[model samples]
Target: MQTQSSFKTTETGTLFLVPTPIGNLDDMTYRAIDTLKSVALIAAEDTRNTQKLLNHFEIETKQISFHEHNTQQRIETLIEKLEAGDDIAQVSDAGMPSISDPGHELVKACIEAGISVVPLPGANAGITALIASGITPQPFTFYGFLPRKGKELTEAVTTLAQKPEALIFYEAPHRLKKTLQALLSTFGVDRKVTLGRELTKKFEEFIRGDLEEVLAWATETELRGEFVMIVAGNPAPDATVSAVATESLSLPEQVEAQIQQGASPNVAIKTVAKANGLKKQVVYNAYHELTE
Candidate 1:
């Protein structure tokens, strides 16, 4: 067991996980600014973007490029510096680091090395959107981003559909419509959803309604900026009934049953495969053999 005392004085340097503003600059907190100014170095996801932020705050602290592409290469170097007692702050392009961005690996290395990791929470797009979404707030699951591929997305949504808590997801504008369609198909038409766009910015807006209604609106609207989607959970009684009905079925039987309940063959196969921890092709072959 490892314990961390964030403020305790240690021979090794502390690793600060600082959250940058998601959109509006005014959202940046005082402690985040103070930490950025106080740290020995800043490990930034995008040096160029981070430089712009530094310029705005007049923070002249040096930055080292630490992003997904260079994470493995940089962790060792950062650890060495931390061991040498050089305090470092890590930041993403926007929002909290390691949410849908980088910084997780370095944090892990620091923890393993017994270096303190102090996180100063400033802004998070997911929580900001959730509180105002008019959805049930407690007992929520934050799924940063869903898979983009068709089969994988369907499988993911199918698994998430069984959860009895609000679900949060981050999506890019270009893929919003497709994701909403996938959610609509998996979670059903009447499931409640809220889409928050340009959060905390001057043009911030939210669209709240059932999945079917939001899907229609997304189809007609021109999507811009990143989005935070809050999806209401499945009804507990229905989810419980469905789980009970499927728990005893064989793989082929499960796929057939899903198909009988209005799911397409491909979706049924993927859902059954995911639920059983089996490959989709295996479920597909099994179901086909049963039919043959």
Candidate 2:
């Protein structure tokens, strides 16, 4: 076991956790491609899907299948590669691999094995949506996707309802309406929400409003493409001494009042943004459109 020979030739390969674009191919970072090219092997959630990306860049590096169904069995093979002096890379079908994806097990196994792991930052649709939603992102929690069952979904959403720093989640097109309903029920009928659909794509759209308004918008629109939802955090209950009491105003209405309180146009816009856990720019645009 601890032989000098074992330590010497052991490659101590680096594991590159690459982040791919959420929608647009142009959003893919150069570093990610470089890492993919240089890695000896890539553990991809889906090989065929990643092959398209590889073909686009002409990266011929071979990929090993390591999806949710096969992750347990593949971890051993992946670890062996790392120990044998071959650097490896991991990527999901889209976005970051470990954030609600199947690559988490590999990351944890690498950590326990004492292998060095490096993560390259790039596009994250969930984060992009949260920041652009004009919601207070700091101290916010990420719940990648909601459970499907009525009972389990309720429990999951309800657990994070008390957070004061907003909540972020991802949802598929078919499940968005149901998840929105769950969010409205858990956070209260009046909670503010920002919904980003088809982010980083031409069809991208952002909807900002209280629960009822946002839910209505979702119902009225054609639900297409991936969805990212940023919900307002629970604010401190009103104590009553000339406090802004952001919770007092409806989301759209509060975003309106920050301007009336002598805050600059931008400040007023961002005030409601932070209060409801969204991006300043998104709120600014909503204000502009609503007033127009």
Candidate 3:
């Protein structure tokens, strides 16, 4: 009663890129299971993780380890099978592949070899968290798990300093506090932030607030679950060219006057920095500005 494309062995015989659920069993799609069962091979980031999923659905398709460590040596063998018209399905341990995962090169090789790749719609913790974050809900950038060291993390955040899009970042539970702290220091404590944990799982939660508030909340409670962080979009500095509270104004009265003229103290400092050809902090030091 199923269509001819029910399994991976459609008339095309292309490789299907499947996305497994991040943490829930019920999230599995029907077409994904049928396709996994039909494919001649199931290339996975972790065979053991995929094993549990396969066993749950009672799928007997053969599993192969195709993670970052050994993919270079295995691509040739995989290509041989594809050339023989044996369709396969590739999956990551969780969520989508090639997005902070190791499937990009493999997928690229398949494409270059004249083999087709069909991506199946499924779960991605980042996008899922973005919608639930209730941030600006506009264009956002996704930066998967950040570099471990503080210096490298700084470089990463600074690289996007001028980007006006909301940013999404994934972080481990242990590194969550440090990551937030680093973001706060680099982006300023007042930047709005949303943190998503245990997404799509029973303990799912989203904490939305300014960076300082959220950072304090994180410290007061025990942090757990996979984290998806959405940071407020960087404001376009060009718009606040007349920010007067920032540069030469050292008194609260002067800063407050600029605020009444529709320029946020932060934006004003940034604007004055450009006008005076100096650093923003250099300008803000004279303004004595802090929202608290």
Whole-model lDDT values for every prediction: 0.86, 0.76, 0.76
Top candidate (TM-score): 1
Ranked by TM-score, top first: 1, 3, 2
Give lDDT tens digits, candidate 3, residues 1-292: 2222334443345778999999998899999999999999999999999999999999999998998899899888888888888888989988998888878887788778767788999999889988888887788888788888544555565455446888989988888888776666446556788998888889988899988899899899998877999888878633322223234554454445434434457654554455445677776776774442
lDDT of 1 by residue, 121-154 (tens): 8899999999999999889999989996665676
Q: Going through the candidates in order, what is the number of backbone clashes in each? A: 0, 9, 0
- Which residue pairs overlap in candidate 1's backbone? none
Clashing pairs in 2: 11-85, 133-278, 133-279, 134-278, 134-279, 135-277, 135-278, 135-279, 136-277
Summing lDDT over every window of 10 consecutive residues in candidate 1, give the lowest-scoring window. Answer: 237-246
TM-score, candidate number 2: 0.76
Worst 10 residues of 3 by lDDT: 237-246
lDDT per residue (tens digit) for residues 1-292 in model 2: 2212322334588788998778899988888999899999999988999999999889999999989999889999999989877899999988998987888888889888877778888888878998888877887888888778654664565456667778888888887877776666446666789989989889899998887788787788778888888988878432111222245665556545544433456555544555466776767777677552
